[model samples]
Target: MVGTAARALIVSERRITGLSQVVIADLVAELGPVWQARRDAELCDRPRRRAVGAGAKYKLVFVDRLLATLVHLRHGITHDVLACWFGVDRSTITRAIGEIRPLLAGRGCRIAPGLRLRTLADVIAHLGATGQTGIIDATEIRVRRPAAHRRGRNRFVSGKSRTNAMKALVVTDDRGRLLFCGEVRAGSVADITQARDAGLVDLLADTVHLEILADAGYQGLAAQTYGQVVTPPRKRRGKNLEQVQWLMAHHEQARFEHSSRRIPVEHGIAHLKNWRALARHHGHRHHLPDTIRAVAGLLSDQQATHKRKLAALPTGQSR
Candidate 1:
């Protein structure tokens, strides 16, 4: 339902989709074939009564569908607003998002063609192989509070943020490039508990070269992983600090150094949150995991492209 002028305007300005023109072009080229193949497979599973071109044509083309989905995820624009922009019904926007989101999620965080990191295990393997230090952290996203009578409603309340929220563990490389985003959990869940539930300890135990830097929230993980997990140094609980000022000063310095190394994860989390879909959720909680993974994939592609550009720049020139 988009008019010719409106479509042209959107095409001319890539910022409407929150992606560079190059990135959007790349996504369209990559997604077109995959989407067509999926539709073909669906037709094969359930034969259409009419021929492929015999039915009513879609108003929004494949590119428009992909653009709408990206805009929604990047800006957190509602289906109603999208409907007005595209001159279509809200259901049209909803259907397009439902169709496109899963494909992006399936692509995962793409470092290169045929080398997407889809799970935590893939992330760990890549880190070990590349000998790069990883930073791990958890972030909370606000969600709608459940009804009073809903079962386990209290589980959604986060003791740290004092709100109804969900928590997700994000893993990034030393330079703050995202590598993986784990599944969402109840906000009330502790950081260490979430890591344990995700089998992070087991994964770290298996790797010899992979090291992860984390904050004080993951205090006990270092011992569990035989020191593969690094956390800030803790002060002696029952010691007379004034009597051992020199030792206390050393511990403070150690903590400072650990924090400096772990700061990149904070930047990574901020980058992820820049996608409004992850900043806050207005949709069903069940849909959040897919959105998170999909956004991470898109962001990773953007970051990878940016890194390539930086590397291409001449020495002594500003990026």
Candidate 2:
């Protein structure tokens, strides 16, 4: 257990870290022995320098490193602040981030396996069995502009936000649990273009019951793909939608209904953005994809934890 002052400096349990203290403690309980073994092996890799008191003990323990990394991801706090918070050197903070990020990313990537809807048969089997579906959409993460002389500076400037950013696709179950994320691309890339390049369209082509919910930016995706795709109906400029299109209450109302089901993807994206690092990354832009994937994995783990708790509750109990 951490001291009160240390707990105050670290993230609050009320905040999202992809894992609560209960979950994180459970994880530590399972991984602590393995991590100590790995640390021993690493130490064995180098012979000890016999000079007395040459190397001092690390300020933060292994569990602290893990906690600190999650805090950084949760709030995008600076390394200097983290060092001060953990009573460690700035380099130690950086090293901890580098080490723990991949583990988190791996956890995020594992969420994809629950989506067994790879083929049309699989999709049919899934919906027929569970009566549920998935949604797909693109979200952008802000990044520093590329160097002036860089080849693709124009490609990274987003038309939507009119700022430099990276684009990624997020897929979620209807309940807003993230299924997949991270086909990270330049901001200027069109949604349909990225969807096709990411093989999202191709994958959906083989699925029948799992619909891909997107905005009209993916207008042509439906024509080129076989799986169900839903989007708001297009409206023409200089003409009111009711007058120029379908009847007064029909078309516009249908779009509203579709949006009701489609709104969950936005919530999923918002959940990811809760990790402010994804909102504005200050590090190497190349690592953005891994960061996004890492966060997605944390979101999945958090969702699973919630589900397990809810399941453990007595039936008919208010959530």
Tens digits of lDDT, candidate 1, 181-295: 8678999999999999989999888889578999989999999999999899887543675757877788899999988888888898898899999999999998888999999
Best candidate, lDDT-wise? Answer: 1
For residues 1-319, write the lDDT of model 2, one tens digit per residue.
2455676445355474556766577546645676667666877778786543356676677688778778888889999988887777899999877877766665443333354222223433454356567677899999988888977579898999999999988877788877778778899999888888876566655566656677778888777765367777765443675565555456678778878988899999998898889989999998788788878766676777778789899999989
- In candidate 2, the residue pairs with backbone N, CA or C atoms under 3 Å apart (3 or more residues apart, or in different chains) clash, namely 108-297, 120-206
List where candidate 1 sits over 4 angstroms from the true fold. 11-14, 237-243
Q: Ten consecutive residues with minimal summed lDDT in candidate 1?
A: 235-244
- The whole-model lDDT of each prediction reads 0.88, 0.73
Estimate the TM-score of every prediction.
Answer: 0.94, 0.81
